[model samples]
Target: MDCTNSKSVLKKLSVALIMFMFLTLTQGYQISFADSVALTNSNTVTVEAHFTTEKIRDGFYTSLVVNYNILDRSNIKPGDKIIIKLPDVCRDIKPIYKTEHFSNCTVNGDTVTLTFGPNINEGVQGYFTLYMYGNSNIKNNQNYEATVTIGNKVVKANIEGVAVDGGDSYPDMYKVFGTNFPVNNLGEGIIVDRNKPVPYTIVVNRGRKNLGTMNLKDTIPNGMALDTSSLKIYEVSPNNNYTDVTNLYLNSGRVNMNYKHLQIYFDPGNMYMVDYNTFVTSTESKYNNTATMTDYYGNVQGQAVAILGSGAGAINVYKTVDKKNIGNFGNQNIIYHIKFDSFGTFLKGTMHIQDKINPKLTDIKVTGTNQFTVKYDSATKTLDAVNDKSTIEPGDNAEITINASMKNVKPGETITNTAQVNGGDTNTVHTTKNPLIQLSKVGIDNPNHLLSGAEFEVINADNNERVSNIVTEKGNTNILITSDKPIKFELPYGNYKLVEIKAPNGYALNTKPIDFSVNANSTIINLTAKDNPTGNIKIIKTNDLKEPLQGAKFNLVKDGKVIKTGETDKEGILEFNNIEVGDYKIVEVSAPKGYEISKDTSVKVNKDQTSLVNIVDKNILGNLNITKIGNDGAKLSGAEFTVEGPNGYKQVVTTDKAGVATLNNIPWGTYTVRETKAPIGYE
Candidate 1:
């Protein structure tokens, strides 16, 4: 009989046996079938067959054992064949038998044939194992049968299906899951974002079966679209080791995809993983996807499911200014606060922010962003910020602050600033300019009296340069504020000083400069400058001649008190500089040598002019000699006399033995002499 025809007949018999067993069970009768069968030859060959594992899973490898024995050796011969035909669900059979009994073993489909060698002996009892895989065509949760023929003898064995529903065995031949955007194995599901991508993995041939020419179809769920460019394939071993095979499989046209599904075709001799990404396209709350793996015959080998839930909500952005009004000058800070709020979902990856500021603003700085780093571009007057490591969960808010300066901006001009978050939400803030300075001038001696005709210059203290563009109420830079009118002007925010360039008539010029600062918070400033009334005094000294004296010391007395002291120059002029306007006396404290001191000369000092006083100091007269005799030209000693001279001068002198009493260094005036004591016998 033809061996190929025998395999067909054996399959029919196995099906009949199953049907008969079913009928017998229904009729309440029990019958037992032998595991061994006798051959139709004189040698009395017997064959028995069974599976090593009682239960086998579909799409997995299992071992089928067949044993044969020759009771009598009379009919043993070389070239004899033993054929084993497995059920259609079983494929890729590999035979393992002793070489002494079989010359070679060959397989066709699910059938294994063994040829006997010349060493065949009587009573030969050896078992051969056939390693095979149960294809997807097999019915699940039932017994699978196979037939064996040894020298025209046939035997059959049953393999029970694994109880997959009871969780006794691994069910699916493939597994699918998501990570990155929605991490796998997390107790709580990850929230999805439209800007984020979700990575998916489909593990095909998970049982490590040699399933030839299979296809995997992964259905993309609603609210998402497949990313074909991100698809990759990896060959995975049973030990969990991975080898990248993306380029090899993709270049060979084995992987393909569309907007809705991704398909991969491969000969899975080992386990393989298909990785790809999907972009969220909708605001749907949940997303579910399924991956199905099928063999060459279009039968589903296994299926797996993956789910992604929750989606991001709209983002809100707001901005505000710390100060609504600021000075136009430099050195003033303008703070802007920006906030971002997430209504729902989790936001990850880099968050970006951009702010465009007014051109007049300078020294831009960013702060208060704990999760972000910021940079500023002066040329563009913009701030760029990014956060790479932080995440924003549902109902969370993030804040950032920006600081800048207002410089060279015109008063009353408004500044507008706008900011955007993540290239989406935008917000704006505004600041107006308000700056002024008021100056009033008064007399230092009389603070209550406001002086006029005072000229002032505005200077920048930072650079020591004269400032321009000053807007005063009088439309001039002169700070000549008086009792009736005060000077008011506008200046940029910065450090500055006021200089008294010119003083009012009759008032002394002030040389000291007053320092001040202009800023945002203090926009208006009030100032007061003081001056003193001043005058000069001139004195002329001579010795009874119309000539100016050189060495004459004088004291300027006010209210009988010495206020100032000075010496005359070659012109005999001693000026009491910048004297207050009041009544005073110019007294000659000491005259030039050989001249008498002048009397206290009454004078007055006035504003903006000099007062002149002339004094004539007569030259010293010849020494005066007096003699007191006893009425007879005789010399008298110890005679006391009183001498009186000009300018209320009086002195007492005693005569010497020569009867001479002298008066020296006296002014030109009439004198009176009177005897106060006489000699011993004279009166």
Candidate 2:
């Protein structure tokens, strides 16, 4: 057995001896024990008193040794008082009493009060010695308890030691033990040894002279169940130990559940033994089992108590997201927790736990206790936590945390992941779908017209802030739109504007920002912009008769420059198309075959507006020559002619020597010629 187990055994023996002696003597006596039994005396000191009698000539030298042990030396000061009220047995026997390490001690009735001085260590000890009458007829197998008072603390003195009384020392008692529940009951609480098998055993002393059938009854502790098939019996031969007699028991199947207890019957002459394994099923830390033994006729033999350690050696995991259920379109943080608990046992072995990280998570970072080493593998997407010295004591837990990020999740898609611990349990979490926005570029004039090479930017019109990198949004990567293709964005719920940043060549830039919302799933928006107008101008060239004239050239001028040059067609129309809205001047560069050049005409062109200007040209003049002869027509000299206009205005012309006269300027109209004077007229 280990040192801890040895201490536990010694403590049990001491308690049994003291209790048996006290109870055996006071069984028929009318004695008043202490009314109340408190667990602790004071925060600074714990007092224990033990009584032992030495054989003397006329009486027994009963010594009541009160050991004052300081639990916290720093908390005690001088002048502290300790009062110990002895059992009724010391009432008439306290003849001579003395103490050590006490400033003063006084006896009053059955109580002794001692005042403390300075110089007290945590391991300090003090004793009180006294004498008792030999004829008192003290009984064996009895325990005498006292009441101890320290400062303002009051408690019962539970100090117990093995008391022989006189005889009755039997060395053939059976022992029951929990192999896995190793503890030093004398020092403090239960101390568990996790490396041992989880089993309970009953062992009988070897070389027994004569033994009868032994009956044992044990109740299973909470959170533990006995494995019926694991029950095994053994018979020791004094020479060869651990001989298996498990098959000899015809009633091995009788170890079934009997109100959460186990009972066994065995003949004790051959040093019989029985053991079974217990399975732990709960998280409770401590387990206690009490076993009682009896002879065939039901005569009480001995009782043994077993307090086992259970509950530890477990791992648990939990996962949480920063965005809760909604998984944003982009990168989001996911947090995980890993916990290891030793339960009611001490874990001192190499422990390793691995978690398969979901492929959707990346950039994993683990932070926790320095005792564990954590590593992540990208190929397998797993995180392994291992340690060589995982010293986790009972009732304590070690936890580690991991933080990771998940990226590029789409809208209406959930990102779910599961985290598991090795030889333990698993937990899962997922995200919900968020809203999305779809934007398309369009022409205002034609809804079906796909406008290419138009770039747009989406911004929060409320604050004029550009939205990007939203955690749950479908990643805010580059949003450069092109080629009339519709652009989709998973954005946070808000009001936004789509502004045209750049437009195609020969197209007007839409300076207006289109406002929309992304409050619901699949929110659709289309931005419309109109192209600048390409207007036209028409010029008609005609004579005074207001008819169409051909072969007329005209220059269309805008802003003092010739924008286009065109001649009138067969219909006498000079037309200019696909021109911007502005003031223009149309000048006739050349006239038709029989018309003069028309003057410049000013006109203003607007969007989808047609302007028409009419230019009238007058006909040119002609010269005529005539000769007056006697009987034949000859070249005339000094001939005069009159040209009449349509408005009744006349012009006179005279023919010169060569019988030629020219009319320099004349209007195109109906005219009549009259010979006013003829030199040598022949007609």
Candidate 3:
């Protein structure tokens, strides 16, 4: 509000004074803002410039008196100068600059929009441009919201600033407008509106006598309380109106200027009030994607029962649609309506009707890339390009791919993918399980690139084991699996045991076991031989000392022929089955008694290993003796007796006789007692 001494000699300034003041204050001293950016959307991206910076000049929409900073380090302009540049984008359509923003960084225009790019390959990216002087100067180092040309639309960002604040030395906060008021008068620093309302965030010291303010009025009358929490100033001013103010509470004990501290105008009819009206008419709003906008204002700031007004002075509060998926709750909205018909008259103040119809935070996009974190330049408003690096083991190739899992994914829908590796890779994987790859209008419909698929594979490794059966599924992007022949696998090459699928194209598939092995403990396996033999065949488990196998089977064969089949019982004895009594070979067809694994490679019907073929399995108890003498018989336990058996068999056993003795299975021989122990009964 350049309400300075321009009125110092108000009623009595010489005609010369008026002329000099007008020349110094409103001449061709233009404010130009540019956003110079070097970007690559592969090369560049489009841009859109919205108006929210230190408001542009006073009257002519473009000739803005920017006080707040928009393109610097802190977002608050501390100086009165700025530089902006936009990306050099190419468009199929022409008529480069919008109505006001021509290639020539025009002086005082309301809006400016230019084009940047849609890279030769895809889209675009770039910068903004700004220029200003006076209270609206682009301060030294402050970041401001800016816009650029993108394909057919405008892209925007908080373009960083180049260090241009206090010329020679770099200071944390630069100063351009009001003089720095002393501690005692901290609050006395005149708040001005340089066409562009300067965004001021004061951090006041505690326990200090805070400063006070008096605007467009003469005397500080009695009982006019100046409570930092609430003020009685509205009563003093003629029109009594304030745009904004911070609340009464302290921020971490410090008095923060959170918009709650704004005071109503002392006199709405003041020329500064004229400036305020202009700010209202040219207001540029940012609807936070909701359907309505909310702006809170208070008069009688210190009073409990003050009626609040909206940005355009109308008194209705608007809410957003509660259809939740669209973030209806935390929506920011605004609508501005204005009528300057009676703007300067005290009596017509009531006739200067105004109202706003703006979008709420719910109406604009709050999705897509939500929050951005990056290194940026203070003066240039350019995002610092970051360099990244990585490495992999020998004999490996690294690939990074992006993908879109579905063809036409709905906005906000979750997505998934499937991937694999041909040449083995050892690189650690970054993946998503049923990763909620949410979809947005910009990125949906992209092909599932290799990288995304690989990541999906990494995440689904544990869950995909059970997916089964794809019935006649086919597509370049669709997963598929089929076997020309049964796939076979085994531990030892030919032992074909199992088969499986590593990755599916589109449809999900399950794993299959192709081949398996078993421990065949089969005994008496069939080994048939055709009969061309001339004689019977016999097989044995042991030499002459033992008979045939206790539980063995055999087949007489002549050239692998089975002449006859026979088995041995628990007793080591077997017959010659049925065969010609001639030269013939005996083959063990079944497992033998008490034998783990043994083979009779080839056995002829010849004499056994020890001949005789007499070994039997019957238990034959050794020699026993019977002795008798007269009437008395003796039963001896420890004496040996010799028995004479037919066939010249001789044997011995301890005598045990009571006129009768027993012997077990004495091999069909007749025996007589040749010797007796102790001359039994005194024989």
Candidate that scores best on lDDT: 1
Error of model 3, residue 636, in angstroms: 30
Residue-by-residue lDDT tens digits, candidate 3, 171-213:
1111121223111111111112112222212111111212232
The list of candidate 3 runs beyond 4 A from truth reads: 1-43, 48-570, 573-683
TM-score of each: 0.38, 0.39, 0.22
Model 1 segments more than 4 A misplaced: 1-214, 219-262, 266-287, 292-328, 331-333, 339-440, 444-506, 509-527, 542-550, 559-563, 569-572, 618-620, 623-683
Predict model 3's lDDT versus the native: 0.24
lDDT values, one for every candidate: 0.64, 0.53, 0.24
lDDT of candidate 1 over 1-683, digit per residue (tens): 11221122122111110111112122222222213333444445555565544556554555555655454444666788887877777765555454545666678777778887765632233445565666667666576778887555577777766533334354335444455332322122232224445666676767776667778788888867998888878888778999999989878988778978888887757788787777666433245666777774455633323222221122335678988876434445788987755332222333577888788877777774555677778888778887544544323446678887776666666788767654433445788777677788887677777677788888889999988667655554534344546666777778998999988777877889999988766555878888778887777776565777788999989888898999988887677777767789988888876677888888887777888878777666767788877768898989999998765769899999998888886666678998999878887
**Between 1 and 3, whose TM-score is larger?**
1
lDDT string, candidate 2, 391-421, tens digits: 4433344656778775544555566655443
TM-score winner = 2
RMSD of 2: 19.5
Residue pairs with backbone overlap in model 1: 329-492, 329-493
Model 2, residue 180: C-alpha shift (Å): 7.5
Q: Which runs of model 2 end up more than 4 angstroms from their true locations?
A: 1-181, 186-196, 204-211, 238-240, 250-261, 297-538, 550-557, 560-570, 574-581, 587-600, 606-610, 617-683
